[model samples]
Target: MSHFGFENDIHSVLKLDMPITNAPMARWQRKASTSTSAHTGALSPSKSANRSLSLSKTPSKTPGKNGKTQSTPSNAGGDRFIPVRNAKQMDVASFLLSKENEPAEESTSAQANQQANQKAWSVTLNGYDLEEAKILHLGGKPLNAPEGYQNNLKVLYSQVPTPVSMKKSRYISSAPERILDAPELRNDFYLNLMDWGRQNLLAVALSEQVYLWDAAQGDITLLKKMEEENSYICSVSWSKDGNFLAIGTSTCKVELWDVQYQKRLRCMDSHTTRVSCLSWNDHVLSSGARSGLIHQHDVRVAEHHTCTLRGHTQEVCGLAWSPDGRYLASGGNDNTVNVWSGAQQTGVHCFTEHEGAVKALAWCPWQSSILATGGGTSDRHIRLWNVNSGSCITAWDTQSQVSSLVFAPNYKELVSGHGFAHDQVSIWKYPSLAKVTDLQGHEGRVLNLSLSPDGSTVASLSADETLRLWKCFEKDPSKKAKPAGASSSIIQQHIR
Candidate 1:
């Protein structure tokens, strides 16, 4: 009071307790009493009495280990205090702050490693790079090696090449070339020849008329005209010997053309709706309609009536006969493929796993029992089946919907055409069902594809209105190379 007399006088005049306001202290006292009473109600009677006795004995102004009065701050609110003498000891606040900072650092490092790895192992395929191929990383760290490090690096480097290999010999030959561009033909109808021989080659069921192209001179000349009066022709198929061409019109009438006479052979009235697909063996001709009916005609006899072979529930899109002439395969818009056989049409097999409608079907020339089917909205897959077991052997996913499909004459590969994209054909290796190559060059949808008799050439007809030819070279010239024979004179001298 003598040294700080003036401040003491001012404090005495103001009459303030401990030179600070006491309102907060009064509220904290009330809160402490309420908390004590609640805890006492929760504790056992003996425990509460012991706690009260201990509190009563404790001094109001006791000093803590830090040499400070153990009085809580009046306005500290609900914050809890932790005394951590060693800085390494963590409180909840500090622990949460560390967790918040860790993920950011880890994410940054991971992103940097990913970018570095992508730059290291980049590759290319079909003029498209690895990024375009969408190669995904399963689980591995980025490989890093020093320059000129050859100890174990050679083996690792050898495995780093692209998985896809592109060779010109693997190209599909049946890709179409631009011969004509006619948008007037709404549907890219499939073409068939009544006679495959040089003189009487006739292209049937064109947009407005039937086109008879000159095979002898390599010229396309319109031989006959049928008006596009009502419906368009959907499909055309030639008989085994190429004597009769079966045309499926939009009206569902199976029109037969006699190639030898260049005249209408006979019109079979069996299908109830537009016939979308047609196929023929040596003696039997089968046609499929939008009404899902499969009509088999015995072309061997004069009376052509529909044989009862009905199992489809939607538009019949594909039909083919086994090479041995024992089984018939039919595919339809119902996403089901059926194989029918037996004396009384009793044996039947159904394949219904395709996610889309089966559009095209073909029997393997070498393995007559093997059948392949391709079609859907996008025709993205080609499925091969074993006819006897009704089991799928292999499947291939393509880039587009398969509009047309044909097996190679040697049965070593398959050629498939997409619906909208012209000048493109997919070549698939047989047995393994691996995609060997994709042929690109057409300007329209490839409507039909066929393999030549010798397996040396493939022909494709496109919606672009041109028939294109592709030459196949499956032979390896290196295998034909011969070594020089040892001199005969040297052999004779040694013998002497």
Candidate 2:
């Protein structure tokens, strides 16, 4: 039969019962069968000539390796190209209609052979036992080996050394825990107007008045208010027992008051100039004045004046008694730090290291011989000194005026209040002097810093008339908090 007649017979045999209208289904037939038009009319001569020329130009087979002729798909380079599918290629319709196979146990001897090979390898390894290890230390001269040393591979297990425990890191909250409006607070850098007492009370002197904030009760009490004009409070300090508070005035007077009765116990007028700083050492209260004189007053007797210390040439703005009460540290506007022995009337060591006014001073609670002092804007340095040796241990440039310094009672850390450029509070690691965190919120220079009795909170006062409290130090959870004013009874007996 003719080729066209054979293709027509095959199409008639494979045709479905229903008529299909899809173009793709129609075009899926062999190219030779689809070469004629649906109207069955013969092509024009020009079109037939062009088709014969295109067919002659396209080579059906390409010459491949070893004189082999490979058949190339006829539709590969055509305009309406359809890819020829191979057995390895996926059938999307078939895959979409296919169902998952049932799970069955594979019974192939290849897996058993693999297991047998692994068992043989493991048994071969177990035949040799390594009971000892000998290490050859290379790079050095050869040493004679002991007799009967075997030259064989051996393994030895050594006990691992325990790792050293790392020190716990400290975290300080950057945000202020509490904020209070301190209206009319003095802006003078020479004044020390804020102090946290051992009774858990915060004493803040605002211009002409002094107030006591009870941390336990969350109440404010008017400790004392100066009614006279031009007579304002310059400094405030709490006694060691927290039963009394010392008030320094701009009028060159120092007044002692009993907080329990809210009455004045006695007033010391030994200072010729304004008293700028006050520190209590047991029954004796030391006051630093603008005259550069430090007066020791015995509050128990009618004659309160004891010994007068004359070392500073300018106003003495900072004073701190050592934890053991064996030494007294005084910082003055003369840029000098004077350390006085308890029994001597003159300073034992007068450190002239600071270039600016030294008003910030703190004694290490853990080390009685170490003292920390900070300088004003001209100096901007924090110096740690060993009072026993009269030598500076270390010093750091704070870059800002140091206004106040307070050592954390329970921690080996120090908190400093700064002014001038940055009105912020800084917490420093002791000995290392590395800064842990900077707590900032004040709009003006920080003028004062005080630590709570528990040493967990720090109270900062700034020239902007705002008082901020930060939870800078954390309390030791292993130890219980001591009762406030436990030693007050003993102190009260002496006062009574």
Candidate 3:
């Protein structure tokens, strides 16, 4: 079995034109009795001298103390390269494949496999990336895309975005998303008139009748009609869960309606004067009265006011509870904003900045301590306060009478509806106190404002007897689908 003779046979089978030069390399072999090649020949002495070098097999692994190798055993008959150094080196295929797929490999450095990690996402924009090479992380998963990441699906390859376009203020629709006539809506300034619920229903009071308008379906249902003479609907507040609607009337009686059944569930007539304003916290209903007193009614089982809050000198017209349902903000014609800690029956803090009546009240979405209060024609200012310390954070002169204010649930902005000259809805860039835009459509003074659940739209009811919807802010369902675990520190939010 001359090695050169075997080479001639392999060369005849493979039909090689170049002569075999590398000797220490191994050649293909078969079982002792069978071979794949059909030809047979004898090798020369020079080639046979190098044949031994190629015939060497990889070294075998030494048995460990536990008497076992941790790696998978290689198949003896599988196609593999036999390293000349040892007999049990096993197969180097996995390692060789890994390097072949590497960004740089010696033999094919210039033409290495260009495939990249498809799940990777590299960031390069300012504030979005720490540096050009730094990979972004989401839920602790690194987005270290390959150097030339054409296959990275997590990244978007495009032109650099314009910064000025992003920082610019947004303008809302000049026309409403909807317009409906509130023919019987009361024009009184001291009355709390309407509220929107998470159930996609807007409850509006028309004279003595309470109607529920389905914002999603455009269907309206009369929830209740006053049964007593001279009794009319004055205030309406939706329960936190949107399962019920609380109605306060001119009879000083507060009634709860189960929205699911469209029927009255309970009634409480504890106030001496007309029930003018209403707000809800969980199962508790707080009703502000023309008597300048606030009464808390436990809707769970009570028929009377649970506890009375005596603070205002005049009518308590505007009222709001913190989202947590732990604190309350009350505005009275006495030109005062009362912040009450739920722990106490009386107001723990009182702020009197507005010279006229304070009617508009809104709690900041991001900063819970911050409260916004709007004044009447004489004051014409929207003031933000730190409820905990009773310090005024910022205030913006609306110029017109501040009728109502509501904070965008998702974005850091608050919208105020004004009366008098403008009768406008002004959206300010929140804590910054910069006006983003003012929307005007109503014919008369804007009396009340309410926000839709899921925080997409706002409904403003004006004294012109028209209800308008403002499509203010909407959330991207895709980014919302991302796991909440993504860190805001590196999160890139598109604000428009």
Candidate 4:
């Protein structure tokens, strides 16, 4: 019967249980007007000395020697004389009035100069003279606004906006693109056994043998085979040009091989223990060992051993160089992540938040200052650090042991491989750390992960003796792919 009862009946029918209160409606109230005003007076100009009253100026005097007076020099450049002629005295007001009454003639040069010196105070926007009301409505305007106010708004809203090609959300295949049998791929979390080279070649170490799979040709080649009884390939890395491959072996030796020629360049033995991880920064090869020492080898020179970094107290497993080659990040079995400043002997920042061994390290390619590190089973946290600040930016618990982390160069996302609970590779949106999707196929721990040169595919090696290539980050259609063998040309240029 009443409005409140009708509303209550409607709510009851809709199954909404909101409490109804009999509150009074709001009403407008007028404020009391006041005649408060301040009295103002017109400004009067300040008095100044009239130039006509004192036309004569005092002559300046120069300082004399020994305070003796001397005749002052004439400041006038030429003839300081003027002919005095009889003239009639006239009132200044009459003189001004006569000058105003004269016919004015403006010179062309003077008019041009004046026009050139003056600046336009008004601006023409989109061929429309903007008024005050139009400017006020630049953001938005009311419905009852004047017609002129809509000119700017019409100009702003009329042009067809660039149709932003809405990027279709990439459909990541739950199934892998290609699967290859990686027999005897070591299950050791401390060892980095796979690397994707810039030449579109994927290198994988399976015990005593190292194999290279060319993505372009889809051909497998045995790059190297160990003949020694106890020696095995522990880690693998490729040079920036992708022409040379660096292999860390169990016998505490680093072998450099020329990929194009298929020949061993040289062997640089520095580590006393097995080399666990290797990274390349231009010509410098950084090798991390189980003895907790990292050696910098100048592969270009005969004296390959250049420097040693001593910070990790245990096995140094993870090694990644920043994209710009400014900093090198290493993770060790001591549950610490150490950031070293370019070939330095000690770490600049030692992060000890990880309770488990830190093994996964990846630098953001887009942001040079950002470094991502993941801890082992005990910690299971993926921490992003601002390397410039020497502080952790953010950390996320993976719940599963993080074995590897690699940032997608094209997308603002991070892909991490996990070990226990679920041997799954997870795609996480960065900065937010929101899980995008979990790629589950590996039966065992996903021990290693590497991104391809084009940043489209990820090569993941698991302890289940399988290497899966997933096309998670697809390339933009507008961009053209790099010419074939571009890295080979780069290497040839270096050789020349």
- Score every model by TM-score: 0.58, 0.63, 0.63, 0.63
Model 4: runs farther than 4 Å from truth? 1-167, 343-346, 477-496
Clashes of 3: 15
Rank ordering of all candidates by lDDT, starting from the highest: 2, 4, 3, 1
Evaluate model 1: give its lDDT.
0.64
On TM-score, the stronger of 3 and 4 is 4
Off by over 4 Å in 1: 1-184, 188-204, 214-216, 221-224, 420-423, 473-496
Question: Candidate 3, residues 293-405: lDDT per residue as tens digits?
Answer: 99988876745567988899999999999877668999999999898877676677898879989989988777777889999999999888888788888877878999899
- Give the true-structure RMSD of model 2: 20.6
lDDT of 2 at 103: 28
Model 3 segments beyond 4 Å from truth? 1-171, 476-496
lDDT per residue for candidate 1 within 1-496, as digits (tens), equals 5869988887787884555654456544555455577763477768765665565442446578999987645446333455546655557669878767778878699789987766555632233235433334344433433322334322232224331222211333233322333234444332222223223453544564555544335456443444557666676777777666777777668888886677887788887788777777677788888888888788667778747677888888788788888888888888888998834454478988777778777889899989999866554678999987888999877757776678876437787877653347777777676665667766777766766545554656666655555555334423422324522121100000
Clashing pairs in 4: none
Question: Which candidate leads in lDDT?
Answer: 2
| TM-score, cand. 1 | 0.58
Model 4 lowest lDDT segment of ten:
28-37
Question: lDDT (0-100) at residue 168 of candidate 3?
Answer: 30
Candidate 3, residue 263: how far the Cα is off, in Å: 1.2
Error of 2 at 296 (Å): 0.9
RMSD of each: 20.7, 20.6, 23.7, 32.7
How close to the true structure is residue 267 of candidate 1, measured as C-alpha lDDT? Answer: 80
Q: Which clashing pairs does model 1 show?
A: 378-401, 379-401, 379-402, 422-442, 422-444, 423-441, 423-442
